[model samples]
Target: MTGGREGRVAVTMPQLGETVAEGTVLRWLKQVGEAVADQEPLLEISTDKVDAEVPSPAAGVLAEIVVGEDETVDVGTVLAHVAPGAPSPGQRAEATGAPPVEPAAEERSPSPPSGERSSPPAGGPRHRHSPRVRRLAHDSGVDLASLTGTGPAGRVTPDDVERAARHAAPEPVPSPEAPVSVPTRAAPQRVSTAAATEPLPSLARSSAPAANRAFRTLVAEVDVPAAQWVGSSDQASVPVPGSAAAAVVAAVAGALRSHPSLLAPGAGADAGDLAVSWSTGSGTTSCLLSQAGELNVGGVAQRLLAGATAGEPPPGAGFTVSLLQDTDVLFEVAEPPPGQVATIVFGTPTRRVVVVDADGSPGIAIRQRSSVALSHDPGTVSREAALAFLRDVVRRAHSRA
Candidate 1:
């Protein structure tokens, strides 16, 4: 945009990835003196990982054009500027205070849905999210239906986007569990699969006059939290070693695929989105939690598991849904159980663990920024039997609640 004194606008093509070199300038969102609002759609960009739209920083005349359309520019390139008083920068340093640039929707990237890669690890068992969050997802075309968290104690994080992309880039050959490379022609047109990137949906300071720095999120109840189940020294207390945890993860993933909206608060709002992850700490094992600024656990998870069934595949696009975290504490989003309340329990060859929740609680026994932990306990009261009883209680409570 024009940099003259008459206009105080500052526009730039913000970067989406730490490693992305260049992106195609597919189109522009605004024109000269467009009377734009802060964070208004200013342009669109199509990169190797995403085809996204950018928002304007302020409301003002688009006085000048530093770069014409169709020019492929490096990150931090000066494209245009909005005049002063038009907009203010957000506290979020990540946002460039500009709109999306470059073309969009031309080609889909091999990125993980929403990038759960940066979330939690998936090498162990899976956890649960909300079901209500799933139902609302269908209406938005966004998927809360399938994110894997990797935060402390298996919580999800915004950075999971990067991890998700990396997971989506390559598929492992099943037989030997090895990375497989296919010839370009045999595979769908693929871009860099291993690089990390982000979707910067930053709003201009001027756009949100009422919501300057902080906003409130939604609240939810766990109703009946998770618990374990068993009968008669039961169905093989543990699966084949690592298989039990895998099954737990698979079950949780099934829930996410059935539900979608657990990822966000409402249509188009970003902050309230839920995050799930897992980790291993010094004392015990745990799942970390970091809620969306405005959302509660039940509200998000309830919507996420509305239509899902046990065998159906989870949603794997637009949002990150995978075991993509680097540390043990992180995990991808698992499935949300149906009903107002849900339950979970784990039994190993030698240990039994059960977690409980009430209607008002999200069922998380412990909560923290870094983790909500559980451990491999071998010495508890009637560990195995207690585990089974708790699971049944949670399931019934959820159904009745």
Candidate 2:
């Protein structure tokens, strides 16, 4: 956030991730000359890592829009300007040369560029199809130019392409004896279990450019005695009745505090106040815990219990943890949610026979173990940093157990 001329504030494109160099302005929530409150959502922007709403820097009237919807610009570029104090409609119009309120329908809908196919005469309006939408249209054998857009400012969204595809006549199926010619294109990367239920078309509709980003998954096996420790009621050292799941969450939070670099590069300097999104059976829940590093296993358990009972977790977290303890899943690769740096998944713990070093002597023993996998955007979190964070989590979990 920066100050501009005439006591106005500049709303620049924010850095959504460490490797995100640019972003596209998807929509402007507040039109020019519209009164905006401080920290109010001013616009929505899409980057490779996430799609997020950019908030206003100050309470004032939106004086000017330097960047329009669907326009891509470098990070830190001024997207708009807001003048402090309430200025009259006439004064605002004179200062910015924009209408006092929303523009007329005709003025709002601009003509498509030359060489682009124009919409049919009976169509709603001209629209700009994003690359993902165009690809989906091509794959589905749907003509984007002929479809009516339902998105903001007449944008051709993936839904329109999917709808068109579903309505179009199906092509004849090739016989078993016929030869097939596969298109020469790179295979699409697999989405994580978190999004496995969603259709490909729906995934394409996501604001984050998942196809363009590089992701890495790391897996580690950890010995967890917390499962037994939590089940036992006779332990005198137990500060509070906590579940193994809550202990894992506390361990991850502590690791995040110790290794700040494991967080998204754009996650600011204060790592103590971190938000973590965790998965319950019903759905995902986000919780913002202050000084999370300082929280113990019992403290985290209480919070989790409260959130589950209330059906709402604390809002805001750039990290996610998915617990698949009850299932037979051994390990899973989970993609981080949009705008988040990484996701940690815990698989079901099982008894395993292994050799252990006891008092400097190797011995055969049966132990309980679980596989923890960390999926992260390599651009935001380095491989080494992720490994260290995972190791720390296991270490902390063992100590707590």
Candidate 3:
């Protein structure tokens, strides 16, 4: 862009990340007419994973500001211009009590103007925006350009972004079966597994948005019986010790293979890759589980524990799982950061195993147990898909017992 005055150096947006195509102008540290030194901070830009200050390219007066704070623009777009010994547009406007004017230009081929701060071509309306609205849109994955503002002067608002995000989210599919189970008068109350146990449909499609669509997420959780998994006490005290966690991971991975929508490529065995987090006496540790083939629970647990002891970051995987022992707490779904699809949490084992006698009377056993949960995006993973996978885990664990 031309400087707000005669001949100046053009300052364009710089490339920030390998995957970033656009960035939001978080703020302008330097205003028009301000003097700047080369390499000094001039503005801030934000992307999904980064927030950084952009420095001035050359030492000079800030003659013009092309992109305003809070605007989102493609990389390489002109942000401003700097000219040596020139009065900035803001200063000139103030001194003369006149509106800020565009820089003088030589006769050039006419074209549409779509730069950061430029108005739309004739016949198209102008959109007004504020910093708060821009930040809100950035955080919520909403596009201001796609929204119709209700604020005065046609400015976008926080409420507008939130409403747009909500409207963009996919509608949840109702479960065919009632999730809540009524407690029997004679038996103790059972925790609800409704979130995870929806009946599976023969074929289901993910509600996850396409790359071009607004990013919207949905959360769900399902509880499973701990006894079905840890019926054999000896299984828990074996060579690997925390085989329970490994077994759960294996079961989840195996189940995910059948639910392609939850997997990365939307299908395949590799899509079943998972990251598991298990608690140790010291703290928690995470490890990657590639295939469900062998499921060496003890070996996996040992590696994870070793990494935690050495203070290493968790291994990467498609999805994440966490196991918390000896608590009455049930699993709950939590919001994940950008790019993560789902999280499975296993809570404290059941206090005691319930058994049936020859008389058909339920009695307490010496074995302890707990429940597991799967929190997933309803758009990418349907309730039916998650429920089916959870059920499969219980079935596989029981068969091993």
After TM-score superposition, the amount by which residue 217's alpha carbon in candidate 2 deviates from its true location, in angstroms, is: 0.9
Ranking, lDDT, top scorer first: 2, 3, 1
lDDT of 3 by residue, 217-266 (tens): 22222223333321223333211225555556666665555443445432
The RMSD (Cα, Å) of candidate 1 is 24.5
Cα lDDT of candidate 2 equals: 0.60
- The whole-model lDDT of each prediction reads 0.32, 0.60, 0.51
lDDT of 1 by residue, 71-176 (tens): 8787777677665342222311112335424223123221223333233344422344334333322222223325655766655443443234223322221122
1-401, model 2: which lDDT tens digit per residue?
A: 23367777899999998999999998787777666677877888999999898988987777788999999999999999988765565656765675655544334222223232333235422355788787556544467778777988578887776666445553332222221121123221122212121211111122334453345666676676545322223432222223666677788887876555455544532554454443344444445566666778778766644443212223345466655534345566556656666777776567766678989999998877666777666554545556667778888877765
* Model 1 TM-score, all chains together: 0.23
Question: What's each prediction's TM-score?
Answer: 0.23, 0.42, 0.39
RMSD of 3: 19.7
| TM-score, cand. 2 | 0.42
RMSD to true structure for each model, in Å? 24.5, 20.2, 19.7
